[model samples]
Target: MLAETDIKDRYTSTNKNFWFKNMPTCKDRQFGWESNNKSVLFVNHGKTTLVDSLLKHSGLLGNGPNVCVMDSNELEKERGMTILSKVTSFMYKGNRINIVDTPGHADFGGEVERILSMVDSVVLVTDATEGPMAQTKFVLTKALQRDLNPIVVLNKIDRPTSRPDEVDSELLDLFMGLDATDKQLDYPILYASAKQGWCTKSLADAQEYIKNPPSDSQMGSLLDTILEYVPHPESVGDLDSEPFRMLVTQIEPNSYLGKCYLGKIQSGRVRVGDQIKALKPESGSNNQEVSKITKILLKRGLLTEEIEEGIAGDIVLVSGLKSASINYTLCSPSVTEPLPFVAVDPPTVSMSFGVNDSPLAGREGTQLTSSLIRDRLLKEAETNVALNVVSGNSSESFEVRGRGELQLSILIETMRREGFELSVSPPRVLLHKDSEKNLVEEPVEEAVVDVDAEMAGIVIEKLTKRKGEMKKYLEVADKVRLVFEIPTRGLLGYISELKNDTRGTGALTHSFLRYEEYKGPIEKARKGPLVATGPVGTCTSYALNLIEPRGKLFIRPGEVVYPGMIVGEYNKDSNDLEVNPTKAKQLTNIRTVHKDERVQLTPVQPWTLEEAIAYVNPGEKIEKERRRF
Candidate 1:
């Protein structure tokens, strides 16, 4: 269990698990991985697939007597990225080892920061081909700063271009660069082809695999390394005699249990029907709430079993706790001391979410009312610590804020899939006042880009135009890796352009940096949008052929068009074009010229929700740019 001092370390580190009851040996183990915080968290940059492979390789995917499995979220599957941090447990040598797989993308770094506090140790997985990529550095630096002991695993060693020794050297440099402690620098390194289901602790053993490939078998070496390297929670001192306390790390809504609060018991014990109260941080006005534990749930693979109780150091899901949220402390009613809470980094991006008022409103989606949208946003705010929702001045709009564009887009995409119709404005950076209350601060991000050597110049030019200040530059083989510090506002819609500039060969990663004094305004990539002059009709190819020459068209030939809907980009000097996309050409009697006979329209480049949101500013029309919505 994490004590008050340990909890303080969590917050100061700039951030910011489970168990099973079994009849195994009944021995009081002092040095085992599962002795205290039986939990180990998996952290990576964008290697969620490796995580899935690890679970399967560990036999947690099948009914192999494992306790639990971390099921990927719905959005995670579509995006090929982990969104929420998940927990699962498996048994290794009689010890119940709880594993948490977190998001690898830099966009979800907030999730990584918050979940780091839940576990006693970490498994820092890095790619074998791309040694110490941007995301690897991002997550590793956070773990190192938290003073968490991490086991570095060179995943995907089966890749033909893998250089295990070189990557090992780079990992050492990265550790030293992050000012890692002597003990942290002496971290264990393992080589594994997670896809092939084999791992070796010895460099020579890993080298021999090239000629005589090892059989696809258990990841025993990696598992044993984890057991040997990861320290037990008991090392942090025993807190079982203290009052019951657990910081809510996550929240979920269960059909049967209503709202389920998932967290590790920091002290004492809890059981079904136990009287407990919610202890909020000192800053909160409502410091406590009287509640009773109606039911206790334990995760076992894909299914959850109803448990009678959970003791200190065990992660459990408690139900019937109303109005509790992430960072809140759930403790015994007899206890008055509130556990320390790690405050998450503030949201960097914000956008307006309003009920669709366009001509196509409610045509494609059923849930178009502001009330429904508001309720959903509020519901999300209850569980998602990275999101913040506030009611707008008008009844038709709400302001949603989050860590980055990707995070906000995921929320919007979820709503879209759930039959939601909303008009979203371009994202803006959230601003805050410094201590003196006079200087305004805007969120900045440490942006890293890896691109082909030939395209490095162009990428730098693009980033420089967006107010990105170069911090570091390195050449790795035929590629160049560049690091910059840029305002969040500059990065909102820059991803699409960056891909274009690098010809899809570049990889970009960014994590939140400290907020600084506001940087000047950033100019938009495109001049303005081609607005539709619509009476609510489908777009015609004849009109599209004409309009596409003026700019890039966004709608297809037969797609429905609506008034005020953005149809294309405005490339000309005109402020905006109210072109009639539904306009039809008159019938021609004869086909004369070769090219004139056919009205071949250019392929429409439709704007994804993220692109569209980034294209438009707050209520400013393309033609009448004077007014701000």
Candidate 2:
């Protein structure tokens, strides 16, 4: 081990080419190539070892922090890894486990693709009841294509209905469907309730496993299983920290730590003041100093703290820099090669985000301008590699695209919560060019629906009418698996409809399948909206009573409403309707006794962010303007 006291020459510079000019002296290719169709060289002389990312372990390797847990955003908490948090380290026996906690949702599948490239293998955790959700299949297929040894943790096995045996059978079937070799069937498995904090060989070891279940189990039973099967990534090449190298996996600006980056060190050792080169992931040979790291540290759960040294394959925190971008490669200035980066999927869905044009636009937000939205999105792009944003051609709007509707909606939801008033465009699929120069639209997903056996046909009929090709229908555990290859447009309205059809008991998961030839006109949503046409004032019971006769109401009496605001679904299948919010009943002294009854309005539908996003129409928008109701 290198002595901690030994020092290295270091300096900071504004030279953007610092990374390309200062290549570290090394004997072999130092960094791993990120796979996207083919592996592209990511970091040159910085030695990187493929790791399984063993998050929970029995023993530690070196002084690197052994326990790495994610501190994710509230949005991520809801969407789960639609953005991922990766904390790095190697477990005992020299195995590098770049622990990646990915979102369970398929919408954030891009995050999984990118994070998986930085490591060697994956530990796919699934609830015993869910048994390899739609995302599990999507994420696992990517890992298998990389020849990654998948270690399955049949988590939540302690539940009364948890079925490890059935799940194990299902797991093998998933593996076989993904084209796994017979050897892969010998894969290792563990049972754990990560919540309960214990893991065992099978249900039989329930007593032993549950004796203690800390988020970080120290008994080492699970870690031992991982090490036994998930072979260590052979240390590739040799590069000393005479210079330092790293990949920027996470980014944040600290009031105390300044600009910081979190990632596993590919090669060499980083000391405070070491002149590290920050290379843009897309930059082939060019690298820049941008700034210098003032400290070496590890993300100890939530925050970063100073550390003595960071080695290859261990998660690290570096500060005292200008700014670091996700997927950027940080390394010795002399290294010429860039580290492999995961290719994030192009956003299939998008929304127009601009200054909210609502009558109450400026009332609820701090910064309400197109320029603020532009600046914020640019800053987001600097960090979030998955988003694609552009100013509207007409300049009155901004076109922001992302992986899926849920993904884009989450962004809008986050901005709304942060007090930003912005109007978004209808979610649309982004088209691209194929090798044949065909005008191919963005790749849609294959929605896999698991519902009660009796309700299978409803799902099939809905997807089929929406241009979904139901390929496989299987009956298992009194539930049916109805798989469909549906366009992105078909899915927009399916979630709510399926929920209603299944009575909220159906399970659906979708992942990006390959882009097929343009599959004709995709189906639009079925329901129209009840648009309030003229005025800014409180909605009254009398006017609501007139409109409630047409469809469900979204606004109640005494609540504010404005022109161009979407009030409720029109119950019909079209757009552009007009209703009056300021309309009140005329008082007449000649009214009959039975006709004198007060106009008691029906209940107004309270809109949650997800529900509103799901309910929006092409011409109408989900306004987040504040109101008393």
Tens digit of per-residue lDDT, candidate 1, span 533-577: 858899987788888888877778888777777788788864888
Write down the RMSD of all candidates, one decimal each.
8.0, 8.2
For residues 1-629, write the lDDT of model 2, one tens digit per residue. 21212111111222312421242222111112121110011111100111222233322222243222342466544432324444533323333333455544666566666666556556666666656655666777778887777677776666666667888898898899999876666788877665444667766787455654454543255666655665554463454524466777667677887767877666666666767777776757454655556877654323344555565555677886674578878887787667877677667777787777777768767868778878888887676777888877557678887777777766776677776777765676776678667576557677778788888878888888777887777765557777788887778756767778889878677877877666777556556778887779998777888888788787778778877777777876676579997786676787644585677676665665655676666666666543321
Best by lDDT: 1
Task: Tell me the TM-score of model 2.
Answer: 0.82
Q: Please tell me which predicted candidate would have the highest TM-score against the true structure.
A: 1
Each prediction's Cα lDDT score?
0.69, 0.62
TM-scores of all candidate predictions against the true structure: 0.85, 0.82
Candidate 2 lDDT at 366 equals 83
Ten residues in sequence with the least summed lDDT for candidate 2: 38-47
What value does the lDDT take at residue 545 in candidate 1?
Answer: 83
